[model samples]
Target: MATAVVGGRLESELVRDGSDRTKGLSRRTVLGTIAWSSLLSACTSPMTSSGETPAANALATPAAGQTLGSGSVRIALIIPASANGNAGAIATGLRNAADLALREFKGADLQILIKDDRGTPEGARAAAGEAIQEGARLILGPLFAPSVSAAAGVARPAGVPIIAFSTDTSVAERGVYLLSFLPQSDVERIVSFAGMRGRHAIAALLPANGYGTVVEAALQKYASASNSRVITIQRYQLDRVSMQVQAEAILPVLQRKEADTLLLPDAGDAAPFLAQYLASKNIRQGDIQILGSGQWDDPRILAEPALRGAWYPGPDRAAYSAFAARYQAAFGAPPVRTASLGYDAVSLAAGLAARYGQQAFTAQTIANPNGFLGVDGAFRFLPDGINQRGLAVYEVGTGTATQIDPAPRTFSRTM
Candidate 1:
């Protein structure tokens, strides 16, 4: 027998159990880690090494009022449950992760009102409005970029803080925090690491989309700061023809050895095919170091022979491994890339409510200079809603990735 806390009521139903806890997380990092050791006792996100799975019937996507937990404080969990394809699948994983978090943190003192965003701005707006009207003090999701923006419109003026899951930095703002793995942070980590290895003069083949735009800006900003120059950049739309055409455009520069590092800031086959294409043109891997954004965290992509020795950034694998094992046991499927955001957000909220009570979601608490160490790694929200994390660097090898640079354990007071 299992009980679910859906809003003000705790229904005796079925759910999942627990798993081992992880000390670190994935998502972001800067050069400096926070040194706020003294703050760990009071406001830091709490962790436990051991957890057991809860046994109960789980819903793939709750239509509404997935009301979880019977705690006094109210919080909202918004996701795109009605969206087509991947968005809906990710929504289920996020909800399960949030439920798993509440189970692990037995002391959590909040009721979660889960709302479906229908994967649209209007849907998210309605969900956010309903949740706030239900007395939600904080909002946890609405995964897509548009949905995050829509929810923020409602949450911001209501004094409700949101820890959204979108990676698009454009939607991030004063009260809307993004907890997804951002492309900009990945660019900074990979480029700076490459600079340390003396592989500067950067060149890139990026997508002609919003994600690509953010990556190019990050590359330019970091390249300028580090005295490195991006000798060339080419953008392509989605489709093999466009990708092939763009990669060919950059072949001349690669053949001339004008760039010491080639940044393939895309995920999936784009990075692999481009690397293979460049190799076929006789641009030896040793001559031009291949760099990738966190999007390269995919195992199959990392293990590609064409991408072997390429470097990228990611959250700690061990923590994700631990978390994934538990999630797999409970949900019976591997988590979506950004699923950890749901777990971390719920865990952090629980800790704040338990410790600081009503003052938990305040800017100061959420933006603790030291940042909170969670399932993905050490991450802290900024007033601008751009989350900073301590990200680890990895190199692709034979069917696996090796950590070349460990993530920072703490944060400095700088940000």
Candidate 2:
């Protein structure tokens, strides 16, 4: 159910006119990011004393000692508040998660200061400045990639650490940590799974974009490390006109039987079309095993006959279901997948309060080898500031997917 970025100049033109098509694309992108969040939120069991998951309290009662201790930690939560869009909804989920953490850790002296980024790079910088002025020690969010980059420029100079929510890895650096689901992690998981199953000759049909470049590199890296070879790597312009041509190009490689697995890292909607196109050329799923990223979790993808038995790595649904139930009960609606990120970030800070004092986002603690359990299983930040997630493998079936390998509860295999 992932909505990919509309291709190049066409998308830019649509944005200028505010066309209905662009609006629809925007909605789909937001939905994709939300679906993206489920992969991040699919973690271990609740971390509450009563064994019940933390939810928004009905009384709205303030926790004991709201203004206690001389050393109070102010965490700035920056998100797009003015825009009644995805970021705004995500911000609400973040606030709820922060509030839940505050209640869960009553003794911790912490305060969350919410700021609106206005969904612009300049706005992000302004928000970061405001957070610094308000004496924030750590910052969370400003979702878009440009905003994350702009916000980081402000936070880095002031020696403040940021737990940004953007999926773009380019923004990650020393003081800025990415808590978003990365395509690299998705590739590594699925590739490693394929390698273990003795299906190593890989062929990729990747989108012609930065994200595609990352996954392409990942496929090469994993293939090389596993003593396997990449048979063919085909790049495609993600448009209707270019799609047929791209599918046609792959027909030769499929006909030659150069690879055991075919990687199609496109949206679920595109899967059926690609499958059918290839099938029409006598290149069916029976010819080669289909592999995909976490974005292929949509049920609609399973309905396509051509994609039956396709394998992709995704978040643990059982874990996500539990978290979603609690979120829906508290917020009166289900949260998008990424709501767990805000909850996890604040919860991490609160959990570290005992060991790291008011400022708990130090590099040493943040890069703990053991990693921490969040809504999205076990995750830990690498030294480079990119976070790695524990993911599971699933095989697409009729109307649904069945989990084949559960996500690791620890980072033993991950590290």
Among the numbered candidates, top lDDT falls to 1
RMSD list, candidates in order: 8.2, 7.4
> Model 1: residues >4 Å from true position, as ranges?
1-53, 56-60, 413-415
Give the lowest summed-lDDT range of ten residues in model 2. 22-31
Question: How much lDDT does each candidate structure score?
Answer: 0.73, 0.68
Candidate 2: where is the Cα deviation over 4 Å?
Answer: 1-71, 105-108
* lDDT digits (tens) for residues 77-184 of candidate 2: 787666443545555666665554454444546677777776678888998998898788888886777888889999998988898877767778878888877888
TM-score of each: 0.84, 0.82
- How many steric overlaps does candidate 1 have? 33
Q: What is the alpha-carbon lDDT of model 1 when measured against the actual structure?
A: 0.73
